[model samples]
Target chain A: MTVFYVITKFLTFPGAITKALFEHIMCKVLKLPVEDTRCLRTDEMCGHIEHELVERPVAGFWLCFIPGLLNFLLGMSLSLFGVINVYCLGNYTGFIQNNALLSNLFASALTGNANLVSTVNFLLPILFLWLGFSMFVNMAPLPEDALMMKEQYKNLNGFLKVLFAPSYFVMRIGAPLERYGVTFILFAVIAVVLAIL
Target chain B: MDNENKNEELFDEASAIEEIEENDQPDVSVEPEQPEQEQPMEPETEQSVEDETVERLNAMGDEIDAEDLGGIPVTPPDDDSVDEETESELCVMCGEKPADKSFGEDYDLCADCRKRLVKAPISFASILFFILIIGVCFFGFLLSASQLSTLQAVSDAYDQAGSNHLYSAIKSLSSAGNIGWKTAKKAVSLYNDSGYLSGIASMVDAYFYDASASSDTKLTWADKVGKGNLNAPWNKDVKKIYSDYNTAMDAYEKYYAYFSEYDEQLYYGEIAVKDVPYDELIQKYETAKQTETESAGLAFISYCEWYLANMCEKGLETELQYMKAVQEACPDFTWLYLTKLTELQISAGEYEAAEANCKKMLQINADDYYGEYFRAMILRRQGKYDEAIAKMDAVIADYENNGFYYAYYEAGINAFLKNDIKQALSYIKVCYEGEYLNYNTANFYALLNKLDNNEEEYQAALDMISSNQAQLSPTVEKYLKKQITAEEMFNGVGNPFEQPAAESEAAE
Candidate 1:
């Protein structure tokens, strides 16, 4: 049992230990029967059990890869656009004399452009990649017995269903809204402000 | 028969006990009567068990007897003592009992609990080790990335500063040697970190172009004279040369300042200085020279006095006399002395003598592009434009081959002034390729555009002129203003030369 627990924990995310502790507490608080508990098991237990094995479909592969690819493309486009703008500005302004007021102003503008592009295009994408990688790591295979046992353990599903159901709405509606709709709205506001100024 | 046998067996076990108890007693104290009574019970039991046992015993009688039993063995009580000693020791980890006993020899660990004890630490350490390794790698990556970013920033700053514009500042910083060099080098290093290799190359170009950036070992001679450390190995000739050079710089600065003020006064129609006592002025100049010359040398003081006297007299001969005196004092002040000699010849209407002196200056400093340009100027003054163009060709070739981008641009301007459009365009192409920035380059391109009747190219050059106007150094601004009218200059231009004009116009 300890070996099974160690192996399962090793395969999970950074906060798996805390998650395991939470699961243990939930089991006790709910007064679940020891016999009904879905405990971590060694591969040897499966080897001993007589059962027909069938391939299970994985949904996370496309979930992770598609978003990762989109983010990469979006970041690349932003970087190229930003660089082009900066290049045009540099060429137009020509040489800025040292210690001159105009030169100092232009220098400040260029520095701002560099910092903005670096943060928005380069840094944000790297962060998204890390988040995507973490999500992929968490999508490991659930055991067959545990999947079967989950049906009997109604509370387990009840708890997770409540926790995860809102995420579906977020992913379906909110993500698209934030990705495109919000961006458009923000841009519109900025344009209006800039026009007025 | 079984009952009789069982009874006899019981009697035999009782008799044997009696016999053993009898044997345990000392021989001297043994009771014969008691033994005789026990012996009867022992025979009875023996006879009942060996009724067939007697027959069996009779058969084994010859083979075995009671005395045949081996000698009685001694037994010790130490086994109980060892058991108590083991029971007293405690387990190292949990201090438990039988469950927490040794797993192996001398290693006290209970079987069930030992697995957790051993595995837990290893598991925790493995997790920690991996986290540490990842953390170090991440830190290293971020550090290098930050360093690269900083380097890029520094490089961009240097590039924006430009070469010719920063020449004087860089030269001043360089002349301070190690102290100045350290700061500039640090700036360059920061630029390199930012991946600005081009900026470093431009800085090196600027360094080489500014002759003043070099050690100016010529100044060290003045140091020797001021310290009066004659015991040190000092070059008497070089010291005398520097002494006169210092004197000339001091006199030039003073006269230039006075002349500039005097010109301003004369322009304002306030020429009160013409009535001032020349003798008193000369005396004051000599007195000031005496005090200031302590830091330079005696020869330097004399040169300053002679120059001031000449300026006061306002006679060409007086200036010539002072120049001759300086020449006699320091024959090795080649560049300055030759320039003075050429000025004297030009003033005396000796064009041939001036041309010869320019040629001599060129010979003395073959790599001096300015010297070559001066020779071309002299030839142009003589109406030998063909010869001047030839000299310009040599200068252009030297500048182009040596990557003297600014010099090449200047040569292009000179060529344009001589009406050699073909040569000027060619040099301008080189300047463009070298990324030299100046208003003149833009103007030359504009002119070429007009000559070729390429409207698009002309507009493009004009746009470039507006863009590059901000980059011009004060010196370049002065030269450009002299070359063209104010109307030709663009609005919003960062003109270093516009200040005086604006001030004067505002006053008016």
Candidate 2:
């Protein structure tokens, strides 16, 4: 599990860095004693910070919740942009016989005759896809943090638990999947399929 | 995203945590060492370890509330004092801190060392890496936007040209500067193929702009565009255009090759013009009519077949019959064929039929000068010289500025037929000075000078006629050799074997 976690962090190094940055900022904001901030670790969190978090459970909850939520949203937005760029706006197979899609897009773009729209359509999606993939793979919190979150859920009132049930379930499931390198595998499969198409 | 699960058993956090709690000890069990008389411990080291433990515990206790500690039992300060005298070992994670708490009978760790076992700290390098990723994305966005704007401009330019706005399109293209293959491909996608064959035409024209481009090069480019874009999958009309274009090009190529071979044979004096393989050339273009009846290529090939028939002394009646069939089948594509057909009808003395064909030509293109010019010639042939002169005058006036020099030349012929010598010279002078001068101009100039008794000019005109010996057909060349008289040649009676009709007295 530790090797898989290390491999996951290696594969999604950008996301790992982003996770560390968010964790550090969260620690500082919550007044927790941050003992270490190294991104690549067998364990995602330090013992002192984890202990401090368990004692101040609300702070710990915020620490896990905010970064996870932001990463999830960022990943989703970037993925959507990538999809639109690949399937809707740009053409990877321009030299192929059925250059119909690009031809049609070209026609529509000319109909509007707006340079700004064409410029945007041409540039942003590729970068968005690259960044989005890393963000998506790292969206899951560390396995221990997930366990801590699950433990904290027991202390929440019925209304709050119901409100956070879906997100909590995602984080719960995503943790083990990320730890075991499942997220990277899924991303690889999807990216390969999309590229082929 | 599954992968090697070899390390799964090595780091089972849930099991390890359960084991730690069940055993009531830290990860490593501690055994207090017996003091040796030879290696006595420094008093200051033990005091500092105790002081550090006290400070760490005090700080941890101040930060977390007792109720929020959840399942973990925090050892109170009074309990720590009770166990201090009995416990003498240092911390398991960090050897510097003294053992302050015990999980099981054999295990112990300081408060700071306990937290270190669970999670690790994030680093500043990770933040710098995040910034680097963002920087790359930002720079890539700017570069792509800059490159794509140029491509977009090129696309818009091509689209403008497709719409027939060539001037503005050229302006846009020039301003966009040179484009690479990648940009060119992108620009091609943006081009609007406005269904007028404009996009394809522009490509073909640009490719064939090199004067040295061979017919095979032309054919290859044509085939590529014809099969690729013209026959594109979606549009039905475009597919049909592709089929028609390919059929026409194939037929045209065969016909052109056959004629070029025939021309070579004739030039080498190996074959007579009468043996020019008229049937073979006819066969080539005639086959194109089977699949396509309305394409410009079909129309052009039909005209070529008619010209070959006329030049080879094949039966004019046969060609006129085929032309009529073509016009019947594809009236929309028969402009050149109809024009030739009208000329043949006029020569055959079918004045009413010739006039009707002229009207049909007018319907195809309202501004067609041939329609009016032919009608005037038909009027002159019918001996309605006044009416012909008036119509020819209108044609000349309406189209003279547009370089319709043929109209003026025809008006000169009408004047000669009307016995108006002064008017004939004036109108013929326009033909003499006009850019439309060719064999017809030279022939008419000879006849005009003969009638006016200008002997010097008459000889000069005859020299002009004889000078085009290589271009003239065998039947026409006999007239230059004096085998036939000026009257016989000018009145369409040059063939010695055919008897001249009384109506042939009129000038051709």
Candidate 3:
């Protein structure tokens, strides 16, 4: 393979996208079915059994939607925290200069828990990166979900197609690349590595 | 015969269709719960009727086979549609009639645009890649941090080197230099642990080398530099600075040795003649065999001459005679020897010989100020006062005259002797206003004032001259008054340069 191939191959795994999708799959599987609760086991008990299956699992669309969104958001937030606290905030000099009040507060806190904070600060980037990439890979799309997206794509008019071209490119190319078993995971890995620097 | 062949073909086709139907049935083991539950009611369902249809098709196949064996010409089935070429498979994406190429089942691709979808390897590797990314980031961070730390160290060293504390400065500079030297030494020590760290860190080799050598040079030179004058010993900030600078040069030499790539550049790997102490060099040079230690001998002799020039304080005349003796013995061996001799000869009042040496001095250096000034002095002593004045003017004109009282004094004295009192006054005025920073210029001002007959100015001038010149011998005073000849004064007094005062304020 040439240099480009080596690079692209290394960057082949979709990280965040796949993680998000995988989480979605889990959420969907764990979710209870709500479509009119059909059951034939002992005709007299069928209604109660259907109610148990549907109501007990608490499978609302929010169950999938909330967690997936929360996971992605948390991953981003933590990575940003890692970057700011670990990378950009070097040796308290800037903080001391910029904010006397906060610096004093931080200094007092540091005096009490220097080792603890330092260790955490040191590991923040690693934890953030790991969890972030995990969520990305877990974000797998279900078959029905994919079919629904295809149906939506087919229904788009010409003007809407032009209007959504960029989004479509991202969905078709970027989303696929970052999907699990895709090179975008590797790219994300490389990017994370670079970002640390 | 054609009808019989057709019937036989129909029988074969019927059997293949039945086999396909049997294979298409759902697995009995898989989805057992769903299938078993459905099987109980299947007698009244579409499945039972489908089974009956299959039995009928089997019967028809059997009949066809019997007919085929009987050699009867059966009519071809009307259901046999007109024979037609098969329609080409169409591409799903572009709706074009595609070439016979397919990537996957149900995916007929066209020749114009065919791309196989390539999947990424390694799944759920977020944590591994994350660790790797962190490792890479930290590697870069560490490299930059190292560089930053080195720079800060060097900066700290510089700050310490500039400090007023000698011990601290010396210690810090030595440490900094050591760091530089070690860094430069390790610049090429790469055995596969290279990355951004080594790439950038290696670039500082030259910087480190330079810092190391400069530090070494300073330290070495500082070791030799003595501290403090007699009155205040070992406590001056200025002294500390000089001492630090002196020692820091050792760093320069070391760095040069360590990293300089050029072949022709000089490197002091070992201490040579210049680094040797003055006393040791003298002792070795005086006793060594000429042929065996020629280079050291030469160096020693040169250094001895320089030492003598700086230390000799007897008088300008003795200094002059010493130079002449060395010159006469060596016969212009070193250009410096001739120059010093000629200069001394002029100071000793040997005008003719000094003038003769001036010609030789000028031959060596045409624009030599020593030759020019002494030449002017010779003319003055020869009683060619106008020519002397003119030459003095020319000499002074060529050089800057900020505080050189002696040069202006010479011109003024000659002008005084020439009876051009106003011109002499002009020259003397400048020399005194220059604060006559040198003690000898007092005589010119006093004499000029006296000749002008301004008794008050003259008396003040005389008093000032008297206050400063306690070393003036009584006989030299008579000579100044023109009451005695130069020979008589020299014969009567011990040393003309000595103060004639039996008790002096300066001595007290």
Q: Pick the candidate with the highest TM-score.
A: 2
Best by lDDT: 2
Q: How many residue pairs clash in each candidate?
A: 5, 24, 53
**For candidate 1, lDDT tens digit of each residue in B1-508?**
3454444443453345455465885443333334534565565544434355435644553433234322323233236778766765555446564444333355454554444432322134334644553453354344334333323443444553344223322333333222211133333443333223344444332221222334644433213211122122322332333334446566556644534554466456465446535565556555765565433333344455454555455666666666665566555545335676666655555678777767665554344455566565565545566676677676666553555564555455556556676776777766654566455455556665556667797677656655643322233344345765322332112232343221221111
lDDT of each: 0.41, 0.57, 0.43
Candidate 1 lDDT over residue span A42-73, tens digit each:
43221111122211221222232233333333
Interface RMSD of each: 21.0, 11.8, 17.5
Tell me the tens digit of each residue's lDDT in model 2 across A1-197. Answer: 66766766776666766766777677766655454555666664411123344445555567777777776665655555455435322332221112333345456654443343334443455556767787878877767777888888889899988998888888889878877778888987887566434
What does DockQ give for each predicted structure? 0.02, 0.08, 0.02
Write the number of the candidate with greater lDDT, choosing between 1 and 2. Answer: 2
List, in the given order, the native-contact fraction of each candidate. 0.00, 0.10, 0.00
Top of the candidates by DockQ: 2
| Model 1, runs deviating above 4 Å | A1-197, B1-264, B272-280, B290-372, B378-508
Better of 1 and 2 by DockQ: 2
- Write model 2 residue lDDT over B1-508, tens digit each, in one string: 1112212221232344446566887755221111311145655545443335434644664433333433443333345665665545677567778775554444456667755543345555766776776665554444344445445666777676566544345446546543422232223322222222234334333321232334554443323321223222333343344344445556556555657777677666677787886776788767866775445555556656766776676676877876776566556544336777887787677889998988876654444677888888777766677787788788777652637776777777677766686787777767766676665665566556766878898778666645654222333345546686533443351232232221111112
